[model samples]
Target: MVTVKAVVAGSFGGPEVLALVDAPDPVAGAGEVVVTVEASGVGYVDIMARRGEYGPLSVPGFTPGVEIAGVVTEVGEGVDGGWLGRRVFSQVQGGGYAQKVLVGADSLATVPEGVGAGEAVAIGVNGLVARIGLERAGVGRGDSVVVRGARGGIGLMAVQQAAALGAEVTAVVSRGRPDDRLEEFGASRVVPSAEAGASAEYDVVLDTVGGAEVGAWVSRLRPNGRFVLCGAAGGAPDTAFGEALLENYHKSPTFIAFSLGSLPGPAIVPQAQVLFEAAAAGRLRGVVQEVLPLAQAHQAHRLVEGGGLFGKVVLTP
Candidate 1:
């Protein structure tokens, strides 16, 4: 019998709950492919899922990873044979922590020739989030944008993506976080989170760290500015506070709570390819802070939860 090594959350609580276990190998279903996972991203959402903070979806025995880059080993009945042995990356509901994963054929994006598996995983998930969020906000050339949580994976990609789209970017990172890569990634200016409100008015505010500060950032928007919330790592804001922020009709502010999962899978597959090609060409950067073995997934979780990392943490199988 074939077995695959995976990190399973024995119980939802902390990093210690993540345990490496050997499970039966997965086989491809119709229209699916089994990939040998070369690298898997450790994201903030994985942390929430592992801690049981993602509501009913965070059940025990779940593997807590969402994105992976690898090579296809087997193709399901309806899949094209050419996909087998191809380098690819995909985003899934879960199961990315395994050495091998079953992926939908339509969800696979070919990794560009120059990009490594770790880089592909970093650029795959977060790049799509940044690109889609910026698109939703109608951000364009000459638009002034502020990216909160700019040091994180999605935020870093947002800075690069916005700049590539010609929007001037102001990255808002908490105090003491690294500012070195911000400008290199296309941020025109970097501001401490505490001082971001007073820094400047922006046509678009792509916020990833939502907390009590949501209201404050919304208040800083230029009239008719768009505020896109792609994540809430800082915690959700109070409803009354949110209501208060919306009461000012004169600002004509547009507020959007964005989730990539809400969109159809096929719609995003092409976008993933665009990012992979851009990264391969050096037009976009894939920031990976560290790569650890699958057995050390607990350590990866701890690093992600502790914060202060400039990029993504990836686990290799």
Candidate 2:
């Protein structure tokens, strides 16, 4: 077995539970490829899995990264050798935090021209979610939109995509001095969360923040407005549906909870191709705020868990 290094989590706890350990290298099975991982992504979901909040999604003694980008180092029996040196990015069923990973051949996609592994992964799943979420929300020209957590990995790209779609966009941030960069990302205005209370005059609200605060944002939606609740960075909100919510806003505002988990699995990678095109053309982007060594996963986890990071935090394995 080829020996390689990976971040393995032995138990559910804080960042301290992550350990960089030597492990047997992966081998590609039929229709699979072994990638020498150049970058792995850390997101709120990775943090949730580490804390045991995902319940049964992960077990002790598992590696913990949800996305990866790399060069194909090996391919399985039926796979073509031409794939051997292709740079690729893919979302995996866990095990992304390693020097090498085995992925289904069909799941692999070439990195767009001129995009590095770190930047590719920074915009990988997170940007794809934003792209898809906006499409699912029917975001269109002349729509007024509000995106909570606007300076985040998902928010950064969401703001860009929404603006490109011709929506008037307002980005909501939680802290620090007002970021002039939000405008650069196509945000028409930046609203700090403290000031966001009850100010919702939006036609569509793409809320990544969940929890007790959701209603305040929802309250501002104009009649028949749509609010897409896709994240729980503050914590998952209390869920309600049907009549009670529809009656509150007079014109039947729509509340949709956007969860990739609830959808069929096969739909993810193919939809991500649109993101590749968007990024390739410079219409979509995400920031890679930091690239830490694989051994420093615990520190990376700590940073992602603490929140308010301005961009994606990637680990080079």
What would the TM-scores of all predictions be?
A: 0.97, 0.94
Cα lDDT tens digits for candidate 2, 1-317: 66999988899999999999999978889999999999999988888888888653568888888789999999998998999999988888678999999998888878878788888888988887787789888999999999999878888878998999999999999787668888998999997888765645888989887777776667777878888887778887755434346557576788887766554434676777777777788877769988999999999988877778888999997
| TM-score of candidate 1 to 2 decimals | 0.97
Off by over 4 Å in 2: 239-249, 262-266
lDDT for each residue of candidate 1 in 112-221, tens digit (9 for 90 to 100): 78999999988888999999999999999999999999999999999999999999999989767548669998999998887664647889999888888787778788
Strongest candidate by lDDT? 1
| Per-residue lDDT of 282 in model 1 | 90
Clashing pairs in 2: none
